[model samples]
Target chain A: MKGILKIAFKLLVNDKGKFAALLMGITFAVFLMVMMTSIFSGVLRSASSVVINIGAKIWVMDPAVTTVANSIPMPDFVQHAVRSINGVKFAVPLYSGSATLRLANGAYQSVSILGLDDTSLLGRPELLEGNITDIFAENGFLVIKDSEINKLNNPHIGTTFELNEHRGVIVGIAKVAANGLFGMPTLYTTYNRAIQYIPSARFTTSYVLVEPKSVELVQHIKDEVKKMGYVAVTNEEFRENISTYYKYKTGLGTNILIMTLISFIVGLSISGQTFYTFILENLDKFGALKAIGAKSRELIIMIVFQAGFTALTGYGLGVGLCTLMIGLAKMRLPNYASVVTFGNLGIAFMMVLIIAIFSSLIGVRKVLKIEPFDVFRG
Target chain B: MAKTAISAHQLVKWFGEGDARTNAVKAASFEANFGEIFYLVGPSGSGKTTLLSMISGILKPDSGSVTIDSTAIWTLSKDELADFRLNRIGFVFQDYHLFPRLTTVENVAIPLILKQRDWDEAIQEALRYLEIVGLKDRAQLPPFKLSGGEQQRVAIARAIVSQPDILIFDEPTASLDGDTGKKIMSFIKDEILNENRCVLVVTHDSRIFEYADKIMKMEDGAVTTIENKSEVK
Candidate 1:
């Protein structure tokens, strides 16, 4: 067993091209999954950050607050009731509405307007090209960096804009927006100012932020808030909730699930078939091993190790490519976009690995059937 | 008393079934003592390789049995057969089936490592055997980097590295040119005669006749003749 392992290891390192291709294939798959999931997670995180980053220890929102990227708002009384409970430091009201920003070219790009209090505590851009608090001025508003500016022929920072029947100044240009959620640029302004443009403000979008006395009190705090006819969720839980919804609801989960299954089949066919072909090509070698007193189990281990090594290598290279991809996305994207995660990386690796190991079984079965005697006659 | 390294008593092997079945080895029986160069020679499909495989315990004979060092080789369990092979038998093939990914030294060390020998010790012994084959310089290069002749030498090194009591060769020189083949034969003979290790070779090349201590010819599925082989071919 040790002998076989040593040989298999050496074999993988010897053929640089085939070995590298296998490794890269695996790595690329890993990288793809990791980067895609991470970016997806990152993007959704940014969308939620509108509320997530507000120093809020807990989030109180509508029952459907599983996802906040496009979460509908609840009544102000609910926010007040949750705030009234003990251990709540403060609760602010936040709201979001959608509108179209007109480019000088007479074209329109969709943008979501976020309403914040004068304290600016509910939700705001973490990274912005201009000031976030400037939204306090009735004449002031924040437009996402990607909005009508670059996409619409580079609108100036101080460009005047019309939205929701309210003409407003671009007091500040938010540096980054999240592309994963709603597929629209974002704008930020005062809650009162936002109410003017959106009559639906009577229904508050989300409770701004909460600060617990201590981390240990988070659960109790959440329980008390949840009892008030609102959902209380931690930041991480909130993020996962939104991701889970997108992953399950909207049938995106189904689509992704189908796509994932398709990828599995494709990977299995390509990697597995290639491995089988490689074994067929090397039948003679297997014969030699048999004649040399190698057992069926030993050969099985050998081929399996080969396939596993190839998949591992490919996964690694795939991950490397994904890393480069993430770097590129971070550089090229205007919004705070994310790619894959380590967990996603592991998933891709395991999938490719399973394909690899599964694919090698065919060769192993064939090798086991070879009669060492037949090798001598030919 | 010196024991025979291998003994076969009316061993039979068949293939397929019903109308498709064919007897590959018909009631073949033979024995070779330790340190003798035993030859099984015949044309293609003459059952020379089949008999060799049966005696080597690679196939279970349909009838009779094979005993190597008094152990019923073909009748033993699969693991037992493997253990016997690991501890007592070595094999070389015409194609030199050396792994393309491994260096000569690594290939040679494989058998010993199979027994869980330490890496350093296995490598040293492998190098020692490779040195015997006069190819230590090519040790680090992958088998592909070497010539067909060099690769065969490496295969020899790998086979003999574990110092098995019996060494089997399947058309060991079939793929080599005449000169290289002759050279390999001489090397094999020297190792057998000097080291006292049993060498069984199945071949059509009569040029190796002078190297064998005894030669048997298989005309059909059984041995037709056995030559003393003391006289020069």
Candidate 2:
């Protein structure tokens, strides 16, 4: 078996150009699989970052709020109902609104405005510059993500802009997980102050952010809030809800899945054709092997060794390139949200293995049917 | 006669179907004893190679049986036949069929490796065969790097590495020049043919007929006559 594999390796490497072409095919497939799935995963992560990046243990919202990205604000009094629940450590009304901020150059850019409670400041962006206390100033202050600084006309500390004719001052610059997928900057302000910045029909809160006394009490609190005729979800459950909505309802999942399948097909064809041709070209040699007493099993093992080695080498390089791209993006683009999770790596591996097995079987068909007598025909 | 190493009776093989059917070999009966180089000589389409293939256990005869060393080769199970071939028979081809990617030594070690022998041990034994064939210095060179004569020597080294009881060569000297052909034939006769082995050669090259102890002449898929040389002269 070891000698069989050694022969397989020697044969594959003997022709450098063909080996490279095979490797290239596999690498391109793995690259496509990893990159497409990663972008989809990144989009999901960004969609759920509202729940994931915040400090809340549970969320209370209107029953119609299916996704964090498309939430319908609940009545303000829902916070009172959540605060009354047993095992609830605290409850605060959280405000979220989208508005156009007029820049110093007179251009208007859209931004997501999040309003945390004035007293608790429940979901403040981590301060990279300036003071967290400045949102409580009399004139009102807003915190902007560092990635969105250009959208605010390259604002420095204490630069002020206008939103819906209301004066919006940038008190701090902070690092947030990712801006929305369309590069929408996020601005943080006090709950009441945010309502004044966005033109709306009523002053309603999007969600009630609740902290439970213990992780064990989250279920108890969720049930109590549900009794008030509202939907209650823990942070992880909210993240899943948002991910599922984007995955199914918006057709993003379908697009990524199609791309993944196309990549697999491309890989299969390239590998299959190359391996079949390779075997055909080597048929005389295989006949020679058979003539010299090599079993069919041994020949099959040799072909499999060739396929598996090709798949693994190409996969490792593909995955390595994906990681390098993501790392560079993270360092260069603050709002770049492409996540390559372990699940994505596992799926890509499975894809390559399938390609390996498929191509090997295809190549093996020709070898198994070879007659040792063929070599003697002059 | 010295103990018969191989005996075949009334072997028949056909190709294709309907009007295209043609007998490649028919009712071919022959016996070869140990310690002699037996030659099958004929023109193209005379079924000389086909007969060699059948007797070497590479092709099954349509209606007859081949017995090698007191065992009916055709009656064994498929795996057993394979084992028998690996342990007892060695075939050298006309094209030399050396894997171009492997060195001469690696090519020679294939039979031992197939028998589940240790790799290092197999290579050592292969080197010994290479030495016997007068190509030990070229053991590390691939087939394409060797001259035609050297490649033939390497193929011979590969054939006899396992010390198989039956050795069959299909036009081994067809690809070589007259001098090279004679040299290879002389080497096989002097170094490889022994009392414990039966050596069979299929060839139409009449220049090296002096190396044969027996020559079976064939025409139109049937053996026409058998000549016993008794000695090289």
Candidate 1: what lDDT? 0.73
Residue by residue across A125-221, what tens digits does model 1's lDDT show?
A: 6645666656665668776666234654555457776665667777776554344355665677787777777656457655546667778878887
Please, what are the lDDT tens digits per residue for candidate 2 over residues A64-173? 88777666877777888788888989999888778888877788888888888989999888888888898887545655665656777777677877888887788777
Q: Among the candidates, what TM-score does chain A have in each?
A: 0.83, 0.95
Question: Residue B141 in candidate 2 has what lDDT?
Answer: 85
**Candidate closest to the true structure, highest TM-score:** 2
Number of the top candidate by DockQ? 2
Listed models, DockQ each? 0.52, 0.71
Alpha-carbon TM-score of each model against the true structure: 0.82, 0.95
Looking at model 2, give its docking quality level: medium
